[model samples]
Target: MPATETSAASTPGAQPSNHITEDEASLYDRQIRLWGLDAQNRMRNSTVLVLSLRSLAHETIKNLVLAGIGRLIIMDGEKVTEEDLGGGFLFREEEGAVGTERTAAALPQIKSLNPLVEVTALPTLEPFVGGDETAMITFLKREKVDVVVACDLSYAQMEAIDAAAHAAHTKFYGAGTYGFYGYVFADLGTHHSFTYTPPGKGAVKEVIRYRSMVQAFDRTNWALTHEKTSEGGSPFGGYRRVLKARQYAPEVAVPVLALWEFEKKHGTLPAGREGQAKELAEITSELQTALGVHPKLLSSSADVVSHFVVHATDYFPPTLAIVGGLLAQDVLRSISRNGWPIVNLLVVDSLRGTATSSPWGVAPDPTPP
Candidate 1:
């Protein structure tokens, strides 16, 4: 495939686009200056899919629109509600309605901000995760979509996107934030994990991290054999390579002696909702206690750290805005350029306020597909 505006490199899509409006062109002047004409055009022509895309993703999507990401698909199992309004950039107050209708209403707002973009929402997780494979294969097969962003994903969803991106030869990126830390990975069309597995978990942390089948495969680092991913898939072992990954705080139940920190902090849910919220809290506590953190994931050497939104638990807009801004910038770099360690893992160290990454797994050497 020739690299053009339409394709990956010099190869522009053979199909022509409708001209941008004066208004649209005017809005993008500053951005156009940064990327220059060709790159801006590429962004106007690119397509992206975001997964496990929580309320936090709304701002990311909004900024992508501003930057002229041509088309977008947002996949999630949850819906918008009054609670979501706290941080959901796409949230709109409607006539007592809370769902896709509100999400749909929000798309025009993006266009209003920047008419160069088009947006779509997928409020269901069925096809994207814990569902039939063929059901969501169409998503990967779509020609217009150039990349997939796995955001705040479930373990199952991440693997699915990883497989789909590899088979399609498309770019893929992933990011996640814990209480105070986060990680991001950029895959430049190469399966990074398939190359060299990371060292195992015995000398580091002995407990099981995640009890899934692909753990061994992931441990193998794919960033080793990148094919010149301009800004992604670093070939060298990063800061994390020389040291042990960090361990998360251990779980030790001291009996429900202290209000579990919910009521004392939030002053309890509103009157009628208290019972339901309490039950929800109970269920979450039980699950956390049961499943626990997968031991393999903790690493002191991890390049990520917490930037928790003060009200991230409540989904505040400003916090999500900052996150969305960061996510979009990374996406732009992954699509427009290559190399410099654009693997699946991006470590943003708050301790020192630095960001670094390791690549995704790469497939073992094989005949060109």
Candidate 2:
């Protein structure tokens, strides 16, 4: 696709489908000045599908809807639990809401967030799961959704969704926050382009080719590869490349990876219990060792592993807000074709107030489909 500038006339009180109306222009005037009318128009025309209604999803939904996306579809089949009431601002003080469906209670608040955007609440995600993907493809086709965001799903479920999105040629994101830790993964597939403005420089055009989560995970390894000798045939020639590529804190990344493995094997998170923390620590140790982290590098990671063990299934609102904010912003960047999107994985450790992103085995194949 070629680049096109916004052609909405500067006339007063114009409301066209492909062009911004006077009221919209005024409402989003500041944002238009920041990202230009074209990007706003792109966002205005795109549809996004967000899975689940957790605290993180709530924050993401708030941002995306306020940004004035054309349509937002939220799907969560469960009822509102008491725990949900504490952190999720969308569910609060509604009559007979506790045992009823979550979507019914949330739709009103979500709609109230932005009347200009269309919000649809689905009762279930059954159509989007399992080996047969016809239902998922149909859902995407019927809605003309440009992006899919999966929140708080199992690794297998997320992998399946990513595959379906890839098959449909749609952008996909999977994000989850566990207590003070969180991560976001993206599979933009081929043909993703964006415009980025540097601090002082003007707009710079960019394109990104993302690998699927499955491929990235499969290629992630801790050991050195393609080791070459220095001038004197020293064996440490490739150590710098290997270590640099693995710079993200292994203590954090290893435990997150272990959490997925634990979920996959046991079909549920290891609840905080006697010996479970030890098991988690063992898993983290195994992963860290497998990834070739120096044993001495992990001397201080005991606290991180213990934190994950106890809080892997818990949700902290503050951390959720941070991850969700970043996730939603990236979604806007993707839809507007502006700024750099998260390449593959992003991890946050709010306990220490730190975050990092690494391109885990993303293959660079930018060929347009």
Candidate 3:
């Protein structure tokens, strides 16, 4: 079937007004006080396109719409199944809900979350399937999308959409959950923002230039080195050894890389099948060697890799909530330009109850002159 677009709003092409209404102001009163009126206005006038309508997307969509994003576009090609109802609150278990298209099944609930927010649904992700992103780029340009959030897609799919987003000059976020683990990656090209300072110092404007996901994944420099201090001596009277680390946790990072590699080679996750764990383990070892990661750091990650291989496709509501909440928060921060956004990659390990950020290929913020 051909691709089609649908909007929950009565007026499909209507753009959000420049100013927030009194009702909107009252509804978002606490958030406005927290981030100030300017940030609220920015969020109220921005449009975000979310790629899939899975569990993570369900959580993110709820947050964005409730927080008063001007418009939201949800694109998904799958149909809702009984399994989806487990983690997808957006999907109901009514008579016809199970077989309905994912986007169609969730549209009413999403719009019901906030009547002020305009919601659109694209019932297919065909445009983003192929290697070329020309169709995706054209769609983004036509819609004037401010940000693109891709949830629960493969690494290649996210990369393709990210390219389209880069071409259209839109901020990009790629997020997905693997059982108890999940990750989020952002590429806001040449992003500019303000950082809080002391009462007398005033806010500081900062600029961060981010690299593409392809570059971040293919980076080869994971080795550490020693350098002399600026004063020509270390505090201990010896040369200071500085480590140039790319990932926040090598144990988690290497396994995730291996998963992506496994998916790329086999065209699917391990899914707990026989010999799949062995294959993933081999891939993990290869990636660790290729990326120059220390064997000791990754030694304890064997169980992580095995668990990931078995449960890569499983979704837990609590895990989704945690990862999705962080992703949504960062999306809001990116839109409002209020706080520090995720530099590039954020990995969440529910087992350890930890969320770590890895700058990856992103460059440091410019030093003040």
Query: Which pairs in model 3 have colliding backbones?
Result: none
* Candidate 1 lDDT, 288-314, residue by residue in tens: 333232334333322111112121133
lDDT string for model 2 (200-303, tens) is: 78877877767677766662332433232111111111352355434555557667888888888888887787887888788878876566566665675687
- Which scores higher on lDDT, 1 or 3? 3
lDDT of each: 0.46, 0.74, 0.77
Q: After the best TM-score superposition of candidate 3, give how far the Cα of residue 24 lies from its true spot, in angstroms.
A: 1.0
TM-score winner among the candidates?
A: 3
Q: What TM-score does structure 3 among the candidates reach?
A: 0.87
What does the lDDT come to for candidate 2? 0.74
In model 2, which range of ten residues has the least summed lDDT? 228-237
Q: Which residue ranges in model 2 land beyond 4 Å of their true spot? A: 1-16, 219-247, 363-369
Q: Please give the lDDT score at residue 94 for candidate 3.
A: 69
RMSD of 2: 6.8
RMSD of 3: 5.1
